[model samples]
Target: MVHYADPSMKYKLSRLNLARTDYLFSRDAAEYATYILNTSPIKANEGRKAHLQLLTKCAAALRDILVFGQACTVHRNIKN
Candidate 1:
């Protein structure tokens, strides 16, 4: 039972019986972030096309963030 600072946004998260898996962010936050980044829109019952599109978008975004984030960190460290 995790105590949440915001009562209105309280959620009871449970452990899933899956190997090598962990939760990073909330579902709502993830969806919102995806939308804000203008990634592929996953529609209900959209089939394989939607799935592929989502994967492609996710891969591109992940690469961009990792590359830029690492670059920024290196630059900051060099300056100090």
Candidate 2:
């Protein structure tokens, strides 16, 4: 029982950490996007694209974290 619980606890902690990282990434991405839109010249399409890409990456990371959480839940259920 202890061994089984240990793995589940670890997974839960990992999920929490992933969630926290995702939150920080989202905040940073939003800040960068706002900075680019507000300070960059309208003609600088490249700068806009770069900022958008960063936001996209952050979104993808969040998606992955959610997927991981789902997988962990599924695995835990299966084990039980």
Candidate 3:
């Protein structure tokens, strides 16, 4: 049984047979989520054109976040 800092959040976390990794963020999780989501494991029932539009939006948003986030970080460092 596992516990959480939040009393209500505490629950029996499943210890399934799976590969373990130090999922500590430090950029790993972000990059992994971005990469994995791009593959979109959930095959949607959307048609070809619809799927392409969805992917295009996802790619654009991902690009914007990376570009703008880097710019903001550099700006913050410069101000500091």
Q: List model 3 lDDT by residue over 1-80, tens digit each.
A: 56588764433232221223444443798898888867765555433234545767543444444443343333345666
Cα-lDDT of candidate 2? 0.69
Find the 10 residues in a row with the least total lDDT in model 1: 11-20
Residues 1-80 of candidate 1 have per-residue lDDT tens digits of 66778765443232342221434446667789878656665465344344556667533344444443443344356666
Off by over 4 Å in 3: 1-24, 45-80
**What lDDT does candidate 2 reach at residue 73?**
38
Q: Scored by Cα lDDT, where does model 1 land?
A: 0.51
TM-score of each: 0.19, 0.37, 0.24
Question: Which candidate leads the pack in lDDT?
Answer: 2
For candidate 3, give the lDDT.
Answer: 0.52
RMSD of 1: 14.6
Predictions ranked by TM-score, top down? 2, 3, 1
Least well predicted 10-residue stretch by lDDT in candidate 3: 10-19
TM match of model 1 to true structure: 0.19
Q: What TM-score does structure 2 among the candidates reach?
A: 0.37
Which has the higher lDDT value, candidate number 1 or candidate number 2? 2
